[model samples]
Target: MSDRDASTPRVILARHGETEWTINGRYTGITELELTPRGEQQVLSTGKLLVGTGKLIDPVQLERVFVSPRRRARKTFELLFGTESELAALNKVEFTEDIAEWGYGAYEGLFGEEIVARRNEQGLDTERPWDIWKDGCEGGESSEQATQRLDSLINRIRDIQRPYMHGEKPVDIVLVAHGHILRAFAKRWLGVPMGSPLAMMLPPGAIGVLSYEEHDINAPAFLVGIALPLEEK
Candidate 1:
């Protein structure tokens, strides 16, 4: 076990706020969509609660940020971190395709009911229904593919954070991306199989925390906390 004073590297996973497709329950993979007015407000509120000094995520401790290439995710990163000048002054931000949402392929823009209907029409088995974790979209990424990409990303993060784990530097990384991809990333962070059931669901603008246990670099990683929107009085 590492010393108690050792700093634990952490990754904060922020899911983008609502889009038209998200609100409508449509599969929005690789589709560019702007945030609704409410979505923008939701992210703004989340930023206030979660980001900055003494907040859930301290800005000074943040080393870098990884963002999905999608517009919604980009907008969320912008809003959460402030204007371009502000973000540039704080941490290095990079847009990565690896962090993009699941490639929905033929299922893109289709609602769950519509996907089921389409499967029935195509003579595909509808008995178990469509679970993205089990039955990946045709012509798109499979569960194994998603797992591989996420694992690769995780490895990169570990490489970046390992040096900081001994308390030489504080490491806090932020990932702004889609709902499905972020949740899957969390599952992989815990070394869980893609085929295993995931009980965690991140709503629009939610923030999930991933960190090492006991501040030991070799310790098992776990989901630390999830920050959700405050209930309106």
Candidate 2:
């Protein structure tokens, strides 16, 4: 998502690979789970494609890595950078709960259909049903709570990149975490409201990049389908 000598800093968001819960569409938050075997291979492939001396994620440009504390997310980091690879030796990696999946609480293992049924059984309002963006999980985090934590993290990232905005600094960073929280993070990155409906998606094991427009920190925007051009012979 960036050049090794990029003047503009960018944030890379990487979702962990598939787990059993991911396949079953279960609300997996806080509860730790390992990546499926296929998931492992998927991450390995992604690493080869994106991380290298001249790739989208040039290791030399990585200022820091914010990863979920969950095992699955950590495993992805290991695979992406390769446990013994020099790139993996970068010293600023942080395993934090702030980027962890949205805490599912009572809906931790429940599917969407099941959550609605449970809410109905408990005599809760079903007219609007169980829209996580709106209703949120009963015992888990409210949209407000998610916003607070993500906003804090976003501020930190911006602080790191702000001074280096027009300078030649390797200020790019990566976030390794679950799907829901990363998506929420993206929303907050663009100053979008939490309750706003999100059609953007970062599927399991997918990579996304966000950055400022025209090197202006005041105009943060999501970077999509970015491709570096071929050099002339």
Candidate 3:
């Protein structure tokens, strides 16, 4: 085991608040959507929860406040941290494309019930039902495809966080993204199969924390923290 002080950098992932589609149980991907009033409230609650935890971020020590380059996610950031002027003053946050939500492909605008109804109309195996993963939505991304995207994003995060594990630099990351993507991310980070994400459910406006334990600089270490409920303010 590498001998280093206990403070290893970690990631705190937050799901963006509800959007119009989200409120209606539609799968949102690639399409930019705005937050509803309740969504905005959730974002504010998240901000208060974070600040109230007394885990006040040391701006200089944090690497970046990475966020998905999507309107809902970006808006959550804006609401939580304020507008452009404040973000510039904070200086450690940045937007990243890798953290974008799952691409829903043709099913981007469809609700789960709609997809199932379509499946029934087509005489497709309704026994299994329609899921984003497993059976997948026709003309859209399969669970595997979604998993691949999540893996790539998690890999980027690992690349940056590895140095902190080795005591090379103090790097902390916070990601603001979507619910499904965050679930996929947590599973991918644990080296779990993406289908396993079906077992890991989170609500909109939830927070998931990931922590790591170091054994070697390059070896896969322990995931000390997994998904946990945020202070539901």
Task: Give the top-scoring candidate (TM-score).
Answer: 2
- Which digits, one per residue and each the tens of the lDDT, describe model 1 over residues 99-133? 99999999899889998888889988757767889
Per-prediction count of colliding residue pairs? 0, 1, 0
* Candidate 2 C-alpha lDDT tens digits along 186-209: 999999988898688887889999
Q: Highest lDDT: which candidate?
A: 2
How large is the C-alpha RMSD of every model relative to the true structure?
4.2, 2.9, 4.7
Q: lDDT at 64 for candidate 3?
A: 68
Off by over 4 Å in 2: 1-6, 85-90, 229-233
Q: Is candidate 2 or candidate 3 better by TM-score?
A: 2
State the lDDT of candidate 3 residue by residue for 1-233, as single tens digits.
64323466667777888888887888888898999999899888877756332243334456768889999998887876667534456677777767788777767788877777877888987577555656666776677887777777667778888766744676767788998778777777777777644376667777766656552434433344443334445
Which wins on lDDT, candidate 2 or candidate 3?
2
Off by over 4 Å in 1: 1-6, 85-91, 224-233
TM-score against native, each model: 0.89, 0.92, 0.79
List candidate 3 stretches off by more than 4 Å: 1-6, 52-58, 85-92, 166-168, 214-233
Residue 46 local lDDT, model 3: 71
Candidate 2 lDDT for residue 159: 90
* CA-lDDT, candidates in order: 0.84, 0.86, 0.71
